[model samples]
Target: MTPLAIAEHAPLFIVLNPASGRGEADNARRSIESACAQAGREHHIYQVDRHRRLQPCVQEAVERAKAVQGVVVAAGGDGTINAVAQATLGSGCAFGVLPQGTFNYFSRTHGIPTDTDEAMRVLLNEQPRAVQVGQVNDRVFLVNASLGLYAQLLEDREAYKAQFGRRRWVALWSALLTALRGHRPWYLHLSWHGVQRDIRTKTLFVANNALQLHQVGLPEADAPEQGQLAAIALKPLSTLSMLGLLVSGARGRLGEADSVVSFPFESMTVRPMRGHRRVKVATDGEIGWCAMPLEFRVSPEPLWLVRPAVAPELEATRQ
Candidate 1:
């Protein structure tokens, strides 16, 4: 299929979450408009704010794109992108990103650039490409989803982002503070790749994208491993040990530590042995409680996303 340029392509629709990136997304409206104007692309841009909900608006835009076989762009952070991506799933409409989020993990993992204008330029010029997608129950996550300490830390981290505001450093501080203040551990039963295991740990991290792991200081597989990797990480023995994990993680020495057990699988199912009706879960920086006996699986079918022509190795090879 021939790649569509922004100016001559079918109608383009963009969903912008104003709450994302600490009001940084608010200015994205003008940037997108300017970029589209420069490209002479006929597009509609929607802004999601406090009063109006996001899903319905995004759903409408995605439907319009599908009807016309155009494109829908999620111009916010990971959470916003999650909602928009779900809407675009199996719709046959091309999906694009602007990466106006704190980590922009999904965008970066797909080889989407962080710079707004550059990302738009890529979107305006490239074709949609296939990339793996992970699902937790019915919900989809582009980066990761986990229970145990990671979920609790994510909940706390959201609160900090709500109060102190955005950025990776804020999340880092929140995780550090949560560790230092003391976090309880729990037992989990996990079944994956035809094996079952019981483990006691503070955080259980199910990873789909390794790009962000490098940001936090963990060494991923030398070559591209499976799209879905599972790591059950134990908490620090003490506050001082938390510091050690931080330093070691940054240096990509986490595999050498006894605190984490890592494995690769096509998919996995996690059940908390504890008698809780719902378990706290974190998917791509979005924190929420999900019904127990969570099932995670990979969809090799891929999410059709727009990236630069010269995409990175990770995004370029999935198809």
Candidate 2:
């Protein structure tokens, strides 16, 4: 597909998450406004706070962008990006991002600058490129989705962030605490592309971001680029063993760990062998519950993401 014709005066509808990063939310808002004003671009900023929820704001932005043939931009963390992507994916409206998050796996993977000023420049000048996405049931996740112990870890990390503030150390500490506390292994029935197996695991993590997979030292890190999703399952382990596995992940050797099982798949279904109808799931760092059996697959259509232009050689390779 050709890139959208983003004229200089093209409207930009942005959905901003107030509580996304450690920086003041107002700062991001001002930065966005200042940039657009300097560029002479028409823009709309929708703030999502306690009173103004995310979904409605995203819906409004998507509708407005669709109406004017403008770009719908997500200006926050992965969760905020996921929400906006859910509304814009396959809607024929271009998607853009400003990385106001700690990890920023999605934006960084696509070469969107983390600096607000640089990101605004890219948003204004870049073209739309088709990007892969993952879906668990009806929910879209740009970075990852997981259940069992990994979901619990995300929940605990949020609690810690709420208390100690949002910092990398706080997230790491929460993971350590959660892992040390130990968790029950889930006996699950998993089927993927016609193969079925029963397994016991502490977590089932599905990754759609190559940057994140590569950071964790998974062999399937290139899966997303290859039009596939990577699944990582952790075998039952003692608390000490689990900590050891975490260390290996930190050192980027997770795929070499004995307790880890990693592979790439197009689609998968997971059901609890214990007859539970609901399970806690984490998608792009947001925690929620989903009724089993959970169906995870790569979305059939790619998301039209507005990002920096790829180099000629790399673009040809992607083709």
Q: How many angstroms is residue 20 displaced in model 1 relative to the true structure, after the best TM-score fit?
A: 0.3
For candidate 2, the TM-score is: 0.95
Q: Candidate 1 vs. truth: CA RMSD?
A: 3.4
Give me the displacement of residue 24 in model 1, in angstroms.
2.3
**What TM-score against the true fold does each predicted structure earn?**
0.90, 0.95
Of the candidates shown, which would achieve the greatest TM-score relative to the real structure? 2
Model 1, poorest ten-residue lDDT window? 216-225
RMSD of each: 3.4, 2.8
Error of 1 at 294 (Å): 1.3
lDDT of 1 at 246: 69
lDDT of 2 by residue, 165-280 (tens): 88999999999999998588999999998889898998999999888787778889889989999999999999889889989989988999988888899999998999789988
The Cα local distance difference test for each model comes to 0.76, 0.88
Steric collisions counted per model? 3, 0
Mind giving the per-residue lDDT tens digits that candidate 1 earns over 166-271?
8788888998887677777777788987899987787888777766565444455411235565454674467787678767777767777777777766777778
lDDT of 2: 0.88
The true-versus-predicted C-alpha distance at residue 130 of model 2, in Å, is: 0.6
Q: Which residue runs of candidate 1 sit more than 4 Å off their true CA positions? A: 1-8, 216-225, 312-319
